[model samples]
Target: MRYLPLSPTEREDMLTRMGLAEIDDLFADAADKLLKAPLDLPRHKSELEVERALGALAAKNLAAGAVPFFLGAGAYKHHVPASVDHLIQRSEFLTSYTPYQPEISQGTLQVLFEFQTQVARLTGMDVANASMYDGSTAAAEAVLMAHRVTRRRNALLSGGLHPHYAETARTLSEMANDDIRILPPDPLAQEDLIAQLDDSLSCVVVQSPDVYGHLRDLRPLADACRAKGVLLVAVVTEILSLGLIESPGAQGADIVVAEGQSIGNGLNFGGPYLGLFATREKYVRQMPGRLCGQTLDSQGRRGFVLTLSTREQHIRREKATSNICTNSGLCALAFSIHLSLLGEKGLRELALVNHANAVALAEAIETIPGVKLLNQSFFNEFCVELPGPAAEFVERAAARNLLAGVPASRLSPRAGLDNLLLVASSELNTDADRATLVAALREEAAR
Candidate 1:
């Protein structure tokens, strides 16, 4: 039998004390659209039956590694060192909770401190937090932080920003009743973001090697925002690009937020990914999540501790910089381990391989009839315009045992980008995989 924590009378008494009429009343502030009927799912099932049903459903998924996969919009397919998995699974790393009491959590705290240093150095920023839930949420938190810093409520998001990231920021900003302006989708990275800036704007959000896979020059936008007293927030969906290209911090981004999944983590069928956030030292207090720092103990021994935790749980709700309760600890540990394995030189070399592979893929696709490469510059991903709907071409490619790429419409359904597709390549993609992808595209074009 299922255990019920509270009896009817106790629940009614608690509700009455809280001035709520019923359990449903507790969710009264939620929007009517969000308050949907309960899902039509089985209330009970035997363990064996449930396992069989789930296995059957899981069998339908096309594993990324099983085919000639090129799919990447945000999440990417990378070669994670077997050692990374082995190291993170150790009892101390896997079983540890938040480093609440630093005395007993030295190992976890030191790892986080190192992770912060790596992210700050990688992004060319003054400091970095331990981690955030993921890239999108880090971005939303960045906007909120900007609002707090500039004492302004308006934010301008470039068209090239990932649609999901934009939506995430929008949802958070709506609650605070802030103004967020997102430009039209620009696959070619041709939007004039400077023209949209004004004194009322708090920040401008732009993605490098943006959603369409075009590498953007944030310098001009950065200069513009600086002139307007606006914070320039740089978003990196593909963190691998940082090794080969100029770091966002060097390019004058007042704030840099990135999805660190490409490094030490796999796509994992979408999540348990890592978020990297960093900024100048002056804005450390305004940063979300936690900051791990080094200190000297009673005997003068070096120790790590939670230097700053501005979340609601650590302080008064009104005084907290963010409501985010915890960091993505295990995922962050995996990322730290992977980066440790790949020293600075190693990361750059790996990045070069990814770029070389993507360049080869782009060259192959250019040879296909009626297909056009959309990016003049990119790191390891780019957009291509096909003769027909991109979604239909993707389906056809899948039937031919090749996972081509992400169709633009899948991410921005209402943007009229049906003919565009986002393709990515990494060290794991071999000549055979590229050839297979090319052959499939050639077949589609011939039709």
Candidate 2:
């Protein structure tokens, strides 16, 4: 009765008032498979019994830290400093909501401003927003922004772009009656993406250290996009890679978007991750999400405020540049805090360690009988072709207490890459972890 506040008669009356025969009728628009599906959960259970049942189900998952983790495609397994977790859990940050009142929300506003500055500096762009929902949505918003800026209806997507991001952009583009031309997956960075550019293209999306872990040369692509009057939207799933690689903006990208999960955030079984979005100063007016700006209050005191007025809430719906009402404020705070702790030099050093570990892992696996390395230029992650089905190898490795890499087939089933496995190495991965991965792969190959 505590959970179900309404009586059966009251529920019936509400349904009648809404002109619905039953509660199920409210889901008329949902597909039959979803609307008619049953959860198969028990109707009632004691608190202790419920906890035990949930714990049993949770135990079935492979904990990232409990095993030798090598899994990475989009989400990575980087070590977060203990201080980050402790600081983020503080009530001031964890309980804060959107900073609607500039005067009273100075702490939240300043944090977001610092986050935007850090993102802009990291991306080598002129400006950056507060943050976005995540990398995938930021990518989709980038496409929409391009459409508005270029006044074009077509986009060109690189083959190596993360499938999830590509799909998100395509879904939004399709809804707007635009064309999304996605190239096939490129295990090798050999695609001539420049040739695909044309005047009708609104934007060209490309990912560096792509899903398969191959770094791309964005300069040539950026040149071609410029020649065709197309916006070059560069996507980076690993923000730390920027410390080692050239910033996408420096390579002529008009806009740069990245996932900020690698620095301060953990895998957390996927999200809530932060999205970093930045662009050239000339195009800042068209950028999606919110932008935090540094200003002086009436008393000549320093203050922070939302700079651009383009989100749906602040403007007419039809005239709004983006509908992103809120941002990942807490995650952005975590990101800024971590980056502040690890300044420019520290970030570079951390990146170097990650690259060294990955190189060591690659070398260790290359000696194995049936595994072959596929990336010539990668930051901390690379793709390997296993002698057997990668999915089977992954399962076998898991049996050996090694949380191995993600199989390419699992992410892109139609790509015909059953033997390709994506492996990543972070600073957290130790010599023992690499050895464990090597031994597991060797054992699987021998079998």
Give the top-scoring candidate (lDDT): 1
Clashing pairs in 2: none
Worst 10 residues of 1 by lDDT: 307-316
Give model 1 RMSD, 1 decimal. 6.5
lDDT of each residue in 1-447, candidate 1, tens digit only: 135679899999999999988898887777585557778886777778879998999889888888888988999888889999998999988888888888999999999989999999999999999999999999999999999999999999999999999999999899889999889999988899999899899999999989988888889889989999999999999998998999999999999999999988988887998989999999988888888989999999999988765445567576788877888888898899999999899899999999999999999999998888999998899999988899999998888778899999999999899999899999989999999988877877778
lDDT tens per residue, model 2, 1-447: 446799999999999999999888887777475535568875777778879998999899879999889988889877777999899899877887777789988989988888888999999999999999899999989988899899897888998999889989889889888899989988987899888888999999999989999999899889889998999999999999999999998999999999998888888777999888999999888888888888999999999988776555568486788777888888888889899999999999999999999999998988998778998989999999888899988887788788899999988888899999999999989899999888888877787
- Candidate 1 deviant stretches above 4 angstroms: 1-56, 310-312
Give Cα distance to truth, residue 1, candidate 1, Å: 14
Count of backbone collisions in candidate 2:
0
As a whole number from 0 to 100, the lDDT of residue 284 in candidate 1 is 86
Error of 2 at 399 (Å): 2.2
Show model 2 residue runs off by greater than 4 Å: 1-57
